[model samples]
Target chain A: MSSPVNPDFLILAVQFVVAFAIAIVSLVGYRMFGSRTLFRMALSFFLIGGGILVQDAGNIATELAGFGPELSILGLVLEALGYFVLAISHIYTVRSEVGAEVSSMTLLLPFFAAAVQPSTALVLEGVARSVSFFLLLYILSENIIFLVKNRNAEALLPIVGFALLLASLFIRLFFVLPTETSDLVDLLKLAGFLILSGPVLVLLVRLRGGPP
Target chain B: MMIVSDILKVVKEEGSKGEGARISSLLRKANLPYNRLTEITDRMVSNGLLEVTPQERGSIYRITPKGEEVLDSLIKFEEFAKAFGLRL
Candidate 1:
């Protein structure tokens, strides 16, 4: 018997490795800063990253279980929901520094929305991706303002990292919108990973110079 | 301690005139000079003690809550240090 081709499985396997690395490095970054907010943001990223890994892993397993596309969509929705929470937490973190303020408890908005509509993967994924994009923008703008006001190398790193991260979201949106083939989206995700991960690793190194 | 000294120094560093010398006034009360009091403020901006607002040449520095806390801790330490006869 010819071995069945599993595209999602292959995609997830690659994503899982990269995402896992990002998560671990960010964890180390936050620990170096020793700031409460940075630590929380790192944890949120780890959760989202790990959740995506699981969602992909689950998608592969479901195919092995003879599950249909509908069940696989459910996995995507869960992953998206996880990403939504991650985005919200990240926004709260950057916003808090400037006293703009967002309640931590309000993160439930996306989580509750996701739980209510687990079946609609497209809708949930769109909402999650869009919000993450906006949050990345919000964070980037704040960092820019900070850089304008402070004009320091320290501030520049986060601004540069987050700007690329926001750009990555645009790439992601293109991938998600056309859903015709997974190839483009997977490539976009890899690009997003590079943009997001590279800066974070640099940030982690910078934080090491500060007092823990 | 150092954070307070940094705030005072940054305030003085911005200019030699205006209410900026309010920090100088306080340091004067402690018999500290605007020129010699450089040890603490240099580190405060980096330590997030004071918010450094950059201008054309120098920057306006304001004390943060972290700086305030450090000042309070310094004050208390000084009081205790005086009681123990350890000259500050």
Candidate 2:
């Protein structure tokens, strides 16, 4: 008899699909804009998607062997690196003049944290999450300032999107919800991504009507 | 380095005024060097983002429909960039 599919597998599949969609949209933006910042963002999303797929595979392997979350650390590290790259992309976006110096650093924090002290993995995860949170906050504040100075209505979209993302990150960092409500954080994060995707998709559609 | 988007913006604003603009006017408005402006305008023309016509005094440049569409997209890009505290 065929075995029943694992629910976790289904969840991972959905995550992979969303990540892939984000990466694809970012890639299209990169091509249209020819901006290195957009290129880095696309690469960041691709890494996140790859991390999800790897994590899913690791989960299946561990489940089959009766192991725990040990192997899943690989995926976690990839995700951390992805976030670091995302931070770098934000840096590039803010300071267009800095090029080679910005792209040179290779993020090894996640891997080092995983390899050197497996027992402190949670702490390392928290640290990485904190870094990402701060970077996102920086981005959000910049957006707010720009909106205030320019009074551009279109700027509101990204401000709202980044605010949602900041909220999700804040919840991840500070709140410890019960199992019943834990999924709320993930849903908020997903909604944040969907919100950010709106401007990107709109740009893509506009590009469709223009020259290649 | 001057961003291509800035050059596009200058061209777009000048072109949208109905009458085509002279290269000197574009240079002053775009705040770009002669060589750089020529290079960008050439590329834009080949990309169908601009239309160039020769007149008695000098060449006249105007934004095509494709150029307007691109400008609309660039405005969106500018919004995205400004959200990150960057210029498009």
The candidate that wins on DockQ is 2
Candidate 2's TM-score reads 0.74
Q: Write the per-residue lDDT of candidate 1 for residues A1-212, one digit (tens) a residue.
A: 21335564565565556556655654553454333433444455555566566666556565566554444444444445445444444455345544424454454565565456654656766666665665555545655654565454445544554555566567767744555544665655555555445444443443444221
Tell how far residue B84 is off in model 1, in angstroms: 47
The list of candidate 1 runs beyond 4 A from truth reads: A1-18, A29-33, A68-118, A125-127, A130-134, A140-181, A200-212, B1-88
Q: Ten residues in a row with the worst lDDT in model 2 chain A?
A: A100-109
Alpha-carbon local distance difference test for all models: 0.50, 0.66
TM-score of chain A of each: 0.59, 0.69
Worst 10-residue lDDT window for candidate 2 chain B reads B79-88
Candidate 2 DockQ category? acceptable
